[model samples]
Target chain A: MTVQEFYEEVGGDYNEIMTRLRTEERIRKFAGMFTRDESYKALVQCINDGNAEDAFRAAHTMKGMCQNMAFTRLYQSSHEITEVLRGKDLESAKQMLDVVTTDYNLVIAGIEKLLA
Target chain B: METMEKDTILIADDAELNREMIKFIFEEQYNIIEAEDGEQAINAIMENSDKICLMFLDLLMPKKSGLDVLRFMNDADYIDYIPVIMITGEATDETDEKAYEYGASDIIYKPFAPNVVMRRAKNIMELFEHRIYLERKLEKRTRQLRESREKLERNNEFLINALSSVVEFRSLESGEHIQRVKYFTQLFLKYIMKMYPQYGITNEQAILIVNASALHDIGKIAIPDSILLKPGRLTAEEFEEMKKHTIYGCELLEKFKQEDNEFYHYCYDICRHHHERHDGNGYPDQLKGDEIPIWAQIVSVVDVYDALVSKRVYKDPFAVEEAARMIMEGECGIFSPEMIDCFKLAKQELFAVTEGKFSFADVMVK
Candidate 1:
C-alpha cells in the first residue's frame, strides 16, 4: 500500500500531512515510527485503571502524534476525549473513548499494511 | 562525530516522533541535537551552551517540564543570548503566559509548518546577533572618547609648560624657581579656600589660579636685557624700565588670546597684579588692600616666599622660618592679612612638597 492508499484506509489527510512533514518518504518513515508508539496502549491501560490524570496525558500525547501524522479522524476523536478527560469527566471520557479507539486501531492497522 | 560548521539547534520533546520531526525540519541548515525529556534537555544545554543558537522546547515532558527548563535557562542567564521557541500540542493561554514569563523567546502551536518555523527561528537569531553587535560598538565608542579626552589634557599641559618657562629660560634662572612658585601658589590657595569661604574660590578656580601663577614672571621676557640681566642694584631709571614688564606680559597675552575665556582672565589678572603690594606702594597700578584679586594676592605672597627662601645669583637662600617671618612682618613686601593666615596654615605641606616627594591633598571641601 502506498502512503496515499494507507491514508485513505485510515481516514487521514494525506495532503495535509505532506504539507507538514514534506514528502512521501518522510510520511512512510514516520508512519513506521507511529506504529511502534505506545501512547494508545498507555491510554487504554490508564482508562481501565481509572487513572484519569495519566489517561488525560496519554490521550493528549496521542492527540499530538495523530495531528502531526494527519490522522484526522483519530486526531478529532482523541482531542474530544482529551478535553473530557482534562475536565475529569471520566464517565463522558470513557464513552468518547470508543470513537477514539476505533480510529486509532484503523490508523495502526493501515500503517502495518503500508509498512509490510 | 565530525565537527559541524553549522550552528547547533536543540530539539527537546518527550515524544521521539516530535523530536525526530523537528530535527528533520532543521537538520539540513543546523546541527541537530535531540533531548527525550526536560532533564536531558538541560544537560544538553549545559554541554553545548556555547554552540546552541536556538531551542525548540516541548511544553509537556516527563522528567522536567518545558517551564522548568525555561526557569533554568533564565537563572543561568542563557535566556538573553539563546532564543527558545516553545512548541506545544496543548498550548493553553495559562501555559503560554507562564512560558513567556519565564523568558521563552516565542511560543508556537503543534503541527507547525516547517517554513514558518524556520523563518521565525532565523529572525530571532538575527535580532540577538544585532543586539550583540550594537553592545560591542557602544563599548568601543566609550573607550575611544576617554582616550581622546586624555590626549587633549596632555596637549594642554605641554603648551602651558612651554609658555610658562619662556621667561625662566631667558632670565638665566633655572626652571625649578618657576616650579617652586607654582607649588607654593597651589599650597596657599588650597589653605585659603578652606580657611576663608568668604573669598568663594572653588577647587577648579584654585587650580586655574595656580596654573596661571606660572606666567606671573612672563612679563620679565620683555624687559631690556641690560636691565633684566643686570647683576647689581638697578638705578631708579632702570628700575622704572624693569617694572613695565608687567604691562608687556598683558600685551603679549592679548596678541595670542584663544577661545578659553576663563583661563585667559586668570592668566591676565595674575600677570599684571602679582607685584601690586597690599599697602599701595608696590608697582605698576599699586592697587591697595583687597582691591587686588585674591588669586593675584596668592601669587604675590608665594612669589615673595619663593624668592626669599630660594638662593639667587647675588644672595644666599634664607631659611623657611625667616622667609615666613619676613612676609608676615611686612619686610619682604606687604601681603593681605587673610593670606598671612593661609601662609601659616600651609607651613607643613609647603615644607613636604618643596622638599620633593610628598603630594598635595584635595581633602578640603566646603
Candidate 2:
C-alpha cells in the first residue's frame, strides 16, 4: 500500500501518541535507575545462572517501561523473549533473548539520545 | 589455589520425604538451599539470591504449582542466571514445553532414579557455567573497548554539541530541540537494541548514536536563517536546500575522522546517513537496504517521526498513529519493513515522551 494509505490505517491516533511520549519522563527515569553497577550486574548474573525465568523477568520489567513509554519495538521483542521462556521454548527463547540483548543496546542508544 | 565450587542448587518441594531424599542424594557434594513451597521458594530465592544457584522444583505441590514458582522468578527480573530443574509426575508435552519456557533447565520425572537426576542436574549446571564463562570473556572485552572509547566520547560530544547549537542558534525556536532529538533518538535506539541485541553495539556506540542524533539538523546551521527559520512552507528549491543538512552533518563528521578514528567512523556513519531510507528513496545519497548503517537508518526514521508529531511553523502536529502510519507507509519505500515495524512499536513511547514535560534529570533518573 502507499504511504498515505498506510498512514490512514495506522496514523489515526497521532495526538495521543505524542502525549504518550511526553508522559514517559518518569518511566525513563525508572530505566535510568537500572544503570547501577550492582543491580545491572546482578541481572546479568541471573540470566547466566540458567534462571531463564529470572532473565526473562528482568527483561519483562524493563520492557514494561519501554511499553508504557511507547518503546513499541522493545516491548514487543522483550515480550517475545520472556514469552518464549514463559512458554518453555528454550532454543527459540535463546534466539529471541539474543534479540532482546541486541535490541537492548538500541534501547540504551535511544535512552542516550533522549538524555542528549 | 582451589577452584571455587560455583554451582549451588535450591530444592523446593512440599513433600518433606521428597526434599530429604533429594538432599541425601547430593548432600555433601553440592551446596543446597531448601524451601517448603512456592512462597518459601520465592522468599529463599530473593533472600539468598547470590549464594544458592540452581533450583530443583517439584511441579505439583500444596501451596503453589511449580509453574507459579517459575513464573514468579521470571517476573522478579534478577540479573544473575539461575537454572531450574522441574521434578514432577506430570510429563505431558504441554507441561514439558511450559516448564522449559518458564526457564527450567531440565525436567525430571518423580518415582525417580537418584543417579539419573544427579547426572542430569550436573550436566545442565556445567552447561550453565560454560555459558557464563563465555559471557565473562565478552564482558571483559567490552570493558576494554569502552575504556578506549572514553577518549573519543569527549571529542565527539564537543563536535555534536557545537553543531547542534549552531542549528539551534540559527532558529529562534527554543534550543530544546537538540535535547529533544537526543531523547527521542535514545528512546528509539533503546527499543530497537532490546529487540535485537546481537548488534554488539557497545554501550559506547549507544552513547555515540544519541550524541550524533542531535547533529541530524546540524547542517541547517549552514542554511540561511531566512530560509531555515522561514515561517511559511519552503519552496521546492528551499526544501532541497534544507536537505543539505544531512550532507553537512556527514562532512563535518568526516572532518573529525581525518585521523582514521574509530569513534569518528561511527559518528560519520550516523551523521552522514541518518537520512537514508530502507527502500532506497531517502536523500543526500540515496543509500538503501543493508547498505545503510543501521543506527543512521534508525535516526532517519525517528527524525521524521518526531518532526511529524511535534509542532512546526509550517505544519501542524499530526496524530501519532498518523505519523507512525506515515513512516510505516514509507513515503516512497524509504524505510525497512522490519524497522518500520520497530518504529511503529516505538511510536507510542515516542509520542508520550514528546508530549510529556519531564526534566532532563527526571527522564534520566530511571
Q: Please give, for residues B104-168, the per-residue lDDT of candidate 1 as tens digits.
A: 88998877888998889999888876776687788889999999987986677557768888888
Off by over 4 Å in 1: A5-11, A32-67, A73-114, B1-6, B35-50, B58-81, B88-106, B134-138, B141-145, B177-217, B226-250, B259-309, B313-349, B357-366
DockQ (Cα-based) for each candidate: 0.53, 0.01
Best by lDDT: 1
Candidate 2 per-residue C-alpha lDDT over A41-94 given as tens digits, one digit per residue, 9 for 90 to 100? 333566667676656545544443343334455556766765666665556765
**Residue B15 lDDT (model 1):** 76
Q: Which candidate's TM-score is highest?
A: 1
Sequence-dependent TM-score of model 1 = 0.68
- The lDDT values for all models are 0.83, 0.66
Q: What's the true lDDT of residue B130 in model 2?
A: 82
Clashes of each: 0, 83
What does TM-score give for chain A of every model?
Answer: 0.95, 0.62
Q: How displaced is residue B173 in candidate 1, in Å?
A: 3.3
| Cα lDDT of model 2 by residue, B156-200, tens digit | 566667767876876876677777677777876786778777666
